[model samples]
Target chain A: MSIEIVNVSKRFGDFVALDSVSVSIPSGQLTALLGPSGGGKSTLLRIIAGLETADSGRIEIEGVDATKLSPQKRNVGFVFQHYAAFKHLSVARNVAFGLEIRKRPKDEIRERVHELLNLVHLSQFADRLPSQLSGGQRQRMALARALAVQPTVLLLDEPFGALDAKVRKELRDWLRRLHDEVHVTTVFVTHDQEEALEVADEIVVINEGRVEQIGSPDELYDSPANDFVMRFLGPVTELGDRLVRPHDLQLLTGGGEPDAVPGRITRITRVGFEIRVVVAVGEQLVTVTLTRNEFLSLGLQVGSEVQVRIAPEVGAVVGQPRLLGAV
Target chain B: MASHPSTRTRRGPVTYLVRLLVIAYLFLLVAWPVYLVGKNTFADGMDNINGILEDPDIVHAITLTVQVAIIAVIINTLFGVGISLLLVRYDFPGKRLLSALLDMPLSVSPIVVGLALVLVYGGRTGWFGPGLESMGFQVIFATPGIVLATVFVALPLVIREVVPVLEEVGEEQEQAARSLGANAWQTFRRITLPSIKWGVVYGVVLSLARSLGEFGAVKVVSGNVLGQTRTATLVVEEKYLNFDKGGAYATAFLLALVAVACIIIVSVIRPKEDR
Candidate 1:
């Protein structure tokens, strides 16, 4: 199901959790509400799930007004950051809860629970309590429980936030695969930009209770609407008056371009296949990234003077005057 | 390892002294007095206990006390769980005031609670007593009055136990259930109630103990009629005041036994829940 949120606003006392935010989530796509902590991404996801009410505006699910609908009536599956597993219930029972609530046939509930558990690769732990499972397994169980009801939309609030980094990456790939298989309208809230960039089909960048930008990962990284979107999506450094990616800043031993700025190499560090060179460009320290082959050929070291220039292609896209959006 | 040994030796004397003091304090304040009560109850080889059990009036008082206690516990459990959920899950005006007032029963004297109930429910001169009596329900000087007093005194026990657990467990699971298409009642039954089960059990056990042992409030509200309004605690007082020492001791022993049993049950249940 597609979800359309129109001019939604919310406040907690004097704190505005969401301004007049509007966004359209397409059907059968994995979309991410991405932002920093307390930036209202989770609140917007909750409002879409009917777990929270918007102060002023409308939510339409599949073109049906769902602003005042209860979460139960909205048929949106939600997964919480903490797993929110029913501690006393076994994994299978947790998965079967929604079906049981709807008074589904016992055999049907069992079959569906079995199917969901297998889908989430948790069939082996179906009878185990959630506490016995690892963080990743518990989150998978929560996902299975959410999907068992065949909800119109699957909404997740930082579903893998509590997991360790390795487990988070595994779940990220698993969620992407699951989305491909299930093809349900899925919206996940996350502050981790990498998670959003790596998994989501479309990304909605939210900040300070408003939508900053919305596009695919490539679109956002290549042509950010503003500085916030650029800085948030990936590592970007200010060169001259423009924000550019570290990898886009090229170093040359001899200056050729008029736009090239001279700087002295302050430090060089090797990470995996890339080398990071920090340059003291006037009062600012700017970092330039180089491939291993490129650094080995240059034989650059600390105290070496070099000229820094933005890559031509990247410069053509991001070298425009910075546009400052609403705070 | 060398530093640890030196620290341990230095702190050993003070630790032992504190342990000794606490043990001595508990033995004198609680263990010794309770042992004496048990000894006196069994002094005549269960004769006192057997005699009290055989007496119709005493038996009636004990039965009445059990009934009133069970009813009060039921009322308190329902009210306590409901109020705890409201306090933890919802926001409204006066929520803090309501939370503060829920603890009033714990801090206020039981006698004051009984008097307050009487002032509102006493048939002769109470605010609503006359009208209630006219409608064929007698609250004061009757079984209902005793129940009201017991319920009042034990009101906070369940809420006190359940509130922290409710807060700790949080509303996330409940919201998850709702998002899974569970209605309010289903969410409570399947999600909220199970997560808070241990808390509610602890609360119910405590409320039961408090209701069973209530004295001052019951004494104030109950008219102390020979067999009608008298409760077990009242029987203990009446027997002692009337020079029937053995009967009083026996009744007190039974009440003490229940309270101790409650404590034992809680301790046994606690470790399993913590796991």
Candidate 2:
């Protein structure tokens, strides 16, 4: 089901958690609400799920105004960040909670629980308590439980936040595949940009209780709506009169081109697949990334003379720099 | 990191001296008195026990005390769970004051609690006593009066036990259950109750112990009528004053044994609370 949020606002005493936030989530696509901490992304997600009430505005789920409806009536499933599994319940019972509450037939509930356990790849652990499982296993069980009742919308708040880095990467890919299989309209809040870029079909970037931009990963990376979006997506370097991304700058061994910005290399560091070169161009410092083959071709070292170039067609202009704090 | 048993450690002679002093103080104050009571009760062996057991008044007193304790524990468990839920889950005016008032039974002496109940529900001049008597029911100096006194003294145990557990568990699982289509009652029965079950058990144990051994308040309100309102402690007091030394010590020994059993049961069932 598609979700349409219009002019929603929320306040916690003196703090404004959401300010007229509006966004449309298309049906059957996984969307990520990405922002820094305290940016109100989680608040917006909770409001849409009906887990929290908005001070103003309406939420429509598939042409139905859901703002006045309770979370149960909205047919929305929510997975908490910490899993929140019942400690007294086994994995099978946890997954069967929603269906059991609906008073489904005993045989049907058992069958559905068995099916969900298999889908989450936890069939063997059906009889184990939540404490007996690892962090990733607990999260997967939480996902299966949320999906048991066949909700129209699935909302998750930092579902993989508590896991280690290696498990997080694994679960991200697993979640992407599971979403593809289920095809449920999903909205998840995340502070990690790489996770959002890799997993979401569309991203809604929020900052200070406002929508900064909404687009696909490539659209956000190539052409950001403002300096906030640009700096939020990745590192931005200031050249002479323009702001450009590190990947957009080119490094050269010889200063032949007239448009090239000449500088001396200060540091060369290999980070995964890309080699980063920090250069001192006059009084300004600029960073450029080159492929291993390109760096090998240049035969460059630290304190070597180099020239940087960003062709007119390749370099996208980001806004000028300002002091970084609340914004 | 390894050290021999004879090795000199960071802790000096003062630490050893302090530990020895604390152990001696507790043993002298607690263990010695308990030993004397046990020694006195069993001094004449089976003859002393048979003498107390043969007395019909002593048997009736023991039975009454057990019945009153059980009834008080049941009533308090229900109200205790309700009050704990209200205190931990919601915020409202006078919440702090309400919590403070729940502790009044603990701070006030049992005799004072009995007097307070009497002032509210005693003779025709008291607040509710006249209305209640006119309705063909009696409260003061009756079974109900004794029960009220015991309930008042045991009220705080269950509430104090359950509140901390409820606060620690939080509303996360309850919210999860709600979003999963469970209503308020279902959520409490399925999620909330099971989570706090251990705390309630611990509280009920304490309440049972307190209600069973209650003497001051029961004595003040019960009138100590023979075979009517006299509990085991009251019987023990009367027997001691009559110079029936064996009967008094035997009844007192029985109450102490029950209290010790309660402690053992509680320790056996206590969850390790991993944190």
Model 2 lDDT, residue A216, Cα = 95
The CA lDDT at A83 in model 1 is: 92
lDDT of 2 by residue, A254-296 (tens): 7688668678999999999999999998887888988899889
- Per-residue CA lDDT of candidate 1, range A45-138, in tens? 9999898899999999988999999999999999999999998899999999889989999999999999899999899998899889999999
Q: Cα deviation of A158 in candidate 2 (Å)?
A: 0.8
Per residue, candidate 2 scores C-alpha lDDT tens digits across B80-115 of 999999999988899999999999999999999888
Candidate 2 — which residues are off by over 4 angstroms? A252-260, A299-301, A304-306, A320-327, B1-22, B270-275
Q: State the lDDT at A130 in candidate 1.
A: 88
Q: Write the per-residue lDDT of candidate 1 for residues B216-237, one digit (tens) a residue.
A: 9889889899889999999999
* Model 2 CAPRI rating: medium
- The interface root-mean-square deviation of each model, in the order shown, is 0.8, 0.8
Q: Give the lDDT of residue A296 in candidate 1.
A: 84
lDDT, candidate 2, at A145: 97
